[model samples]
Structures are given as C-alpha cells and as structure tokens.
Target: MKTLLLLLFLLLLPIKTYSAVIEKIEIIGLKWTKEKFVRRELLFKEGDNFSKEKLKNSIRNLLNTHLFYKITPEVKEKDGKVTVVLKTKERFPIVPIPKFRAKTNRAFKTGIEIRDYNFRGMGNHIFLGLTKWFKNEHSERNFYINSMFYRIIKDRIDVGITLNFFNSYNNVFTKDNKVLGNYDLKSFKANVYMIEYLDLEKIRRLMLSFRPEINKYSNWIESTNQYYLSLGFTVDKTTDMVYYTEGSFYSFYIDFAEPNLSTVFTGSLIGTYSNSLKRGNINTLSFGGSVGTKIGYSGNGFLLDSGIPGYVSDKVKGKRFFNFKIFYRLALINKTVFIKPTIAGGDAFSNIPDNFLISPGFEVEAFWARLVDGIIRFKIFKGIGSGSDVQTSLKLGFRW
Candidate 1:
C-alpha cells in the first residue's frame, strides 16, 4: 500500500510550460473604423503564441489598407503571459478631388471626382467623377461611377462595379500632322468584376470581369453593342501602399471583346520597382507595354496616350506598343513634399509610326494628412520618328 501511494503522488506532479500565451489585446486611436475590422486584420489572437513575425506581418497588412497614417505595436510580459497593444492614427477618408490639364495645340481637359475611401465605417470604396474637354465649339463629356465591396471572410473576396457614359466630338489628325476631320461619338458601358485572394503570402490576387457596352456614332456611322470578358492577376509586395518606398508590383491581364458579334483580343503587362535611399529619399522605376489586334472583321484597336508623362496618347494609333520610364524623387520639407524628375520614352509599331519617342519631365507633389494633398506637373516631349512633334503639357490636381 505504501509503494502504490508513492507512485500515484509522483505521477500527479505539475508539468512546466515554456510557451508564452497571449493574455490580452488592446487597440487604441480608432475614430471612424470599427474595432472588429481592425482585429480582423491581425494575425494573432487571444490565447495564441506570441510571435514577432506574425506581429510584423499584421502591422504591414494594416498599413497596406491605407486606413491609418501611423501604426505602432507594443508587447508586455507579466506572470509568464504576454499582452499585445496596437496604436494607430486614422487618416481622413473622404476626398473631393479636382483635376485640370492642358497640352500644346491640344484641347484642355478638366474634371472633378469625389471618393469615399471608408464608406459607412466599412472598408468599401465609392467614387463619382465627371470630365469635360473644351476645343473651340467642339466639346466632350465623360461621367463615371465606381464602387468596391469586400467580404468579411478569411479569403477576403472583393467585388467591384463600374458605370460610364461618354460623348465626344473629336478631331482626327493625319500622318503628316494635318487635321483630317471631326466626328461625334457616344457610348455607355457597365462593368462588373470579382477579385479573389489566393491565400498566398503577402497579397496575390486574381480577377475576373465582364462588361457590356453600347456605342453610337453620328453622320451615317453604324451603332453597335458589345460584350467583353477579362482575366487579370496581380502580385503586390509593396511595403508602403500610400507612399511606396520599397518592394515590387507586377500585373498582367488579357481581354476579349465581341463587338458586333466579332471577336477581338488585347493583352497588357506592367511592373514597378521602388527602393528607399538613405536620408529619406526614394527611387522608382516602371515599365509597361500593351498589344491589341483585330481578328477577321473586328474594328477595335489600341491607342497610345499621354498616360505616360511626355507622351501623348492620341498622337499614336497602333495595334501594339511599348514604353519605359525612370523616376527619382528628392525629399523636402519633412518628407511630406517631394520634387520628382522623370524621363520616359516609348514607340508604337504596326499601323502607327515606328519611331522612338523621348520625353523629360518634372513634378512637384505635396502630401499632408492635416490639410490636403496636391501635385503640379510639367513635361516636354519630342518625337524621333514620323508623325512626331515636340509637345508640352501642364497638369494640376488637388485632393482633401
């Protein structure tokens, strides 16, 4: 009986545990966002093991949303347990934006856009925009509505919808830089897209989209209806979403359209890389190219635009093109203001001038969370081949 009692006592001895368990989680500085939304983005939960890597990734995920201007994490240990604390400063979510641009010997365009980054305290985004172009008595107008919704699931699926209407009286140019004629175009379109997070490390997404559109042209042009389908993929590893200072981004997409029951195909690829230098300076480089071709009786094509600084999109019309750009920015005024000088050039081939184009430009941008964000830019571009001309452009925009 004594031996049996001693064996039972030895078996009942307490075992020691070494892993630190989370005791509590504290979140501070929330003005418009819900606590659950912030907690949903976290990688660690109560009673989970304390992991520094998970905490760092949680902070990065929160910052990528652009919902906070500052985020800090703190850990406290007591009685063999740990407490995690998060401190955040929220950004102003609503913005009323105005934009204006003009080019040498080209029509001036002006527009206004309103965006709500945080709609109804959720992570949804909504935007309404209008644009107008003035060229003598010929004017053009465009209106659009865009919205995005995110599901609160583990995979975090996102859906977006867009509506657009446009009416334009455009002047056409010839190969020798002469005005060919003016035509009136009217169009309306509706688009729906869904993005699925592929449960990959650090933000990889896939998108599927469908669009239906109708267009009418004046002066004995045929009116038509079209349907489009698209597939897209993106890999974003950027450290800072608002002001990208490091990491890389890559995206590729292909689109198919049935215009008047004829099949057309288009595809594009784009990439960007950014790095932060010492003393608060940043450098960024980007390059992109697109190809569009018609099959059989398809009439749709691709056009290059001033989408790239110093290059005019309307100046080139082609079935395929490529472009490259380099930008370096100097930090000034507490890192909130930046002076960026850039150089970009590209050429269009197949149905357009096969000449190389070069453009050099500079930009001034100021970003402040307290007041407003604004930018002023100027660029000068020269074409090196046929149908090329030296052009200058100015642009201004404000958001708050």
Candidate 2:
C-alpha cells in the first residue's frame, strides 16, 4: 500500500509544478516624460522568472526622485510571467535663494525677534527686517535711540527711543496740503514695520518710518511706508534710505514718498552686492539711483535736496546719488573687519547732480574687541561740469 501511494504523489507533484510556470507579464503606466528628466530602466531581464519583490523595488526607486507628485505601479500576468507598469505625475522644482539673516545680539537676548526660518518660503520672493540700537556706557552717560522695522506681512515689528541726542525736525506736506513740521522732545521715534508681498518671483519689501516729526499735518501723524526690492542680502539703514537698488547679489530698495495730501511722486532705487573669495578676502559692489523733484518737506527730504546750482546752474536741485564699492570682509585674530574703496556721486553734494562731480573714498569697519566695533570713513569730493570741490570728511562711530 505504501509503494502505491508514493507513486501517486510523484505523479501529482509534476502536474502541480507545470501549472505554476508563468507564460507572460505586462507592465504599463509611467508617470514621467522621456524628455528633461530621464527615467530608470526596468531591472527584470526578459524571459526570467518574475519575482513580485523585485518588481515592487523598481517602482520605489523611480518615486524617490522627488520630481513626481504622484506615483502608481501596476503589474499584469499572462500564460507564465508578469509585467509591471508605473503611472507617475511629474512635479516642477522651485529653487529658492536663501537669505543669510541676522539680528542684533541684544535682540536675541531680549527675545524681541521671534521666528523659525530667516528666509520665508510662502511667496516667490520676500524681505523682512528689524533693528534697534541703544548705548548706555554708564548710568551717568546714557544715550538711547535707533530703531527701524520692515516686514512682508506676519513678519515682525521694531520700535526705538532715545533720551539724549541731537535735535532734528521733520516737516510734512502733501499735494493740496499745508506745510507742517515739528521738533521732537528729543527726536525719538516709534513705528510698525509692514511688508507687502507681490506675486513676482523676485524679492520685494517695504519699511515705514512713522516717527511723528510732522505733528501738524494729518498725513504726518500716521507713518508712511517705503518699499525695497532685492535678489539677496542687505545690511545698513542708509542704503535703504538713499541708494535702494543696485548690485547683482546683494540688497536693493525703492522708495515712494508723497508730497502733499497723498500725492506720491518721490521715488528712489538702490542696490548693493558682495562676494567672498579664498585667502580670507571678499569683493563687493553697490550702486543706486532716482528721478524726482525737490518739493517741500517730508521724511528723508533732506536727501532730495539735489544741491545743484540752477537751470544752467551746473547742478540739479533734487536728490540724486550713486556709489561704487569694493570691499573685503577679513578675519584676524578671531575678529573681522570690512574694508572697502568707495566712489560716490553725491556724498554731501555740490551744485549739480551730475557724473562730473565725483567723490573718491574708503570705509573701514574694525572689530577691535569682541563687543566693540568701530567705523571710520573719509571721502574727497570734487564737483562735475563745474570745478566746485570739497574736503574729505571723516565719520567715527562705535558699535556694541
């Protein structure tokens, strides 16, 4: 009986094995196009025994490119083998040039600046800023003042105040508006930084200074907003004020201020850029421009005074400035210094705003101590079209 059963089992085993042989497999549905991005080839060889595990792996590899928004793989079998097909949707990659953002050491300690990423990823491009400075060498010698804020919605706010300082007045006006200006108890300022976002792929930002220097005028009572645009980095308030646009990979700005009753006509453009090279050296370029009238008073109006003589006065009577800069950010003994050669068109101004007038100068930022930074700059300005010339002036300041 045992021998008869063994013979039957052998006969049945051969029949079952033959039934398991795959005849054909079909694969279909691919997600990516043949152009632009190349797809990986199928790993399974023709006429080979199909393994489900091997087919599944091939589908997974294709999806890892991150270029696909969706991926689906299907397999079909006929007679003896199985075929696999992948259906995929390709995704476009959007590259973002990140901004190396920073804030004052005091801001970090006070927790005044709060955010996760320095470079916001919501819109195609955006810019935001907040800065405040205060100096209290001793209780007897107290000087407090310096603050500005620029944002692109849901970004940040900056406020500043000073107790002892030079006295300055702000005059306000508008189209069909009356002239009004005022002197602050000490020229203290406080403002909200609002940033506007556009659908453009390039960075856009605006900062407003609502210091109530023009108390008599209604428009001056509320702060006015200024715009700045750029492709990458920015550092310094003056650049944002005068030359708002220039440079290839740095900061850029555009300002639109009104004259009387919201009659916005005054505008300015500026930009700046810098690069780091081998041997602890750096290269930088900065330039900016604007075209407008030197009307009555307003924020930053002191700058618009072209200082040009007259019609043939060898000077344009509006605000105009241009600057070319090459600088290096160097490190020595655990400290850094930014040294640059600068050529400016309107460094203090002559009679006419022209290419003829040129000021050649150099600026230095020395980091002597970990907490002490010093800045000194000098320029020799010569007038163009005319022979008017001015002596070089030196600026000295300390930063903590």
**Best-fitting candidate, scored by lDDT:** 1
Candidate 1: C-alpha RMSD after superposition: 6.5
lDDT of 1 by residue, 1-400 (tens): 9999999998899977577899999999998778887887788899998988889888888776777878889999998799999998887777777867675867788999988777877667898999998774457789999998855345478888999999877645354687666668889999999988775344788889999999887765668888878888888776663553456666767666665543434433333333333233344443334334333342434332324344445545444555666667666565566666667666655556457767676666767643223444445665554455666655554432
Query: How many clashes in each candidate?
Result: 3, 43
Q: List the residue pairs that clash in candidate 1.
A: 304-313, 305-313, 306-313
**Number of the predicted model whose TM-score against the real structure is largest:** 1
- Give the CA lDDT, 0 to 100, for residue 11 in model 1: 87
Q: Candidate 1 regions off by >4 Å?
A: 1-18, 99-111, 131-139, 152-155, 168-185, 200-202, 241-244, 261-300, 303-317, 351-354, 370-400
Candidate 2 on 18-94: residue-level lDDT in tens?
32233443433323234212222244545666666656554443332223435566667675655545565544323
